[model samples]
Target: MIQTGQSIPEVVVQQITPKGIEKTDTVSLFGTGKTVLFAVPGAFTPTCSEQHLPGFVQHFDEFRRQGYDVACMAVNDPFVMQAWMKSAGVPDGMRMVADGNAELARALGLELDASAYGMGIRSKRFAMLIQDGAVKQLFVEAPGEFRVSTAEHMLEAIAG
Candidate 1:
């Protein structure tokens, strides 16, 4: 697991936009300014859809007010990410990034294998407060835990 004060890995991810598909690197994603990046194990999974992503979606405005560019990533294809965003009612503030081959997850050293649950090579559920492409704070969950490292928690961390 990558820690705070470490530079984020230079990993390229596929951005699925209504316009089309495009490639973007991690620096490109977080370079504009401070960014709040959260990763989930899988797209459309119960916890991700019902809680994790929705927490971010609901608190996106607050995150933006605190000067953070918000993004969500998963180890799934671009098309699936796009569809899941729609189904989950993702708001405009949150950008959905696709780590199609788990490259980004691997680069972050946050990759997880969930073969028993039928998910192969997925990202762990974690959130990081990154500034200028470097990690400022990291909140990673233990397997199946979702209380901390949430959008609300990250917001509080930013506030304090």
Candidate 2:
């Protein structure tokens, strides 16, 4: 797993934009400023659609007010991510990352072997605070648990 003080790996990723799918790199995405990057196993999964993503959407302003850029990453493709963003009514403050091949997850050492679940390789539920290319804090949830990585928890953690 990526430890605090370590720089985020430079891996190319994709995101769905108004124009089309845009290719971007992790360094440019999370390296330049304070970023709250949250990951889910897959897009449209129950917990992810109901709680995980919504929590971030609800507290997005709080994060932004504190000058943190919020982003969501999933192992799904850009098309799925874009659909989820629209369906969830995600605000403009949040950026969606499509880790289709789990490249970023593997780089962070946060990949989950979910083949048994028929999901193939996916990202574990986690959140990280990255500042100026280095990780400041990391909250990785235990398997089948939702606690530390929630937006509310992250807000409290950051405040402290």
Candidate 3:
């Protein structure tokens, strides 16, 4: 798994744009600023929809005030992610990123095999603070758990 001070992999991540789905390198998204990034197992899942994502959206302005750009990533396509954002009423402060094919998830060593559950490979729940292209802090949840990798937890870590 990627650790503190390690550079994130330069993989392609897609997001919805006015014209259509636009693709960009992962580094470009989390590489340059004090970035707050959280990953969920999948979009629209029970915990993710009801809790994980909402927490971030609620704290989005606070994260920005703390000098961070917040984003949520999933192992879903950009279209699905966009739809999820609308469905969940996610605010503009939080951007949705698609790691389709698990590219970034695999590079971070956070891929969870869920074939038995018919979900294939998905990202493990995680939140991290990235600064100037390097990881400053990372909180990866235990299997099927969601205790640490939360917006509040990340904010607390950042405050300290």
lDDT (CA) per prediction? 0.89, 0.94, 0.89
lDDT of 3 by residue, 48-140 (tens): 999999999888889999999988999998989988988888876577899989999999999999899999999999999999888999999
Best by lDDT: 2
| lDDT per residue (tens digit) for residues 81-158 in model 2 | 999999998998589999999999999999999999999999999998999999999999999999999999999878
Model 2: runs farther than 4 Å from truth? none
TM-score quality measure for candidate 2: 0.98
Q: Which ten residues in a row have the lowest lDDT in candidate 2?
A: 15-24
Could you tell which candidate, 1 or 2, scores higher by lDDT?
Answer: 2
lDDT of 2: 0.94
Superposed on all Cα atoms, model 2 deviates from the true structure by an RMSD in Å of 0.7
**Clash-forming residue pairs, model 1:** none
Expressed as tens digits, the lDDT of each residue in 1-160 for candidate 1 is 7888888889889976666668989888886599999999989899999899999999999898888988999999999999998998887757899999999899889999988888888999999999998899998899989977799999989998
Write down the worst ten-residue block by lDDT for model 3.
15-24
